[model samples]
Target: MADFDIELDASGLNCPLPVLKARKELNGMKTGQKLRLIATDTGADKDIAAFAKMTSNPLLDFYIDGEKRYFLIEKGAN
Candidate 1:
């Protein structure tokens, strides 16, 4: 179990909620910090990836476990 600087559980949330929460969580993190987002929404795969690309954040990892989608995003330079 790797410890992330920010852990956001967006399971059961709808589209935008996961992305929104991820953004907010990342906003409070310092540069180089990591955010782990756990989401159950299927759309999160694309949504989160696009969010990271659009925001210029590094998408460290993206994978699926059972019904959950996990995203590891590293905070980008300010």
Candidate 2:
């Protein structure tokens, strides 16, 4: 896996918040940068994947540790 350039702890947030904040953060980042997003929202499983696809960002990895979910996403040129 690639090292993340930034980390966003969206743990405790729900649904769109996590994806929204991720989009906001990614907007400020350079292309090819990576984001490590830690979220507890169950909805993130689908939301994050859809958001990545919609924005052209690439989700590099994902895993669950108990209730916590981790997403590794790479910013794309789009």
Candidate 3:
């Protein structure tokens, strides 16, 4: 399986932008690849979760570090 290689920094972006950027980043990855998303938007916690569910992608992990929120998502089958 391919490992996570993409890093999307959405720290300054808001709700939709964070999710939208993540979606766009995921689109450029192959199946089994992973994406690392960094965002400061508080809403992204919920938005990213819902985005993963809606797209059927797997959210490998999520956590908050100080002021930053990080998400690791694995690309799903297309």
- What is the C-alpha lDDT profile of model 1 across 19-64, one tens digit per residue? 9998898888899999999999999899999999999888989889
Quality of model 3 by C-alpha lDDT? 0.89
Give TM-scores for every candidate, taking all chains together and pairing residue i with residue i. 0.93, 0.95, 0.93
Give, for candidate 3, the lowest lDDT window spanning 10 residues: 1-10
- Higher-ranked by lDDT: 2 or 3: 2
* lDDT of each residue in 35-70, candidate 2, tens digit only: 999999999998999999888999999999999999
Candidate 3 lDDT over 1-78, as tens digits, reads: 235678889998987999999989888889988898999999999999999999988998999998799999999998
**Candidate 3 TM-score versus the reference:** 0.93
Ordered list by TM-score, greatest first: 2, 1, 3
Q: Pick the candidate with the highest TM-score.
A: 2
Model 1 misplaced regions, further than 4 Å: 1-3
Better of 1 and 2 by lDDT: 2
- Against the true structure, what is every candidate's RMSD? 1.3, 1.0, 2.4
* Best model per lDDT: 2
Residue 41 error, candidate 2, Å: 0.3
Better of 2 and 3 by TM-score: 2
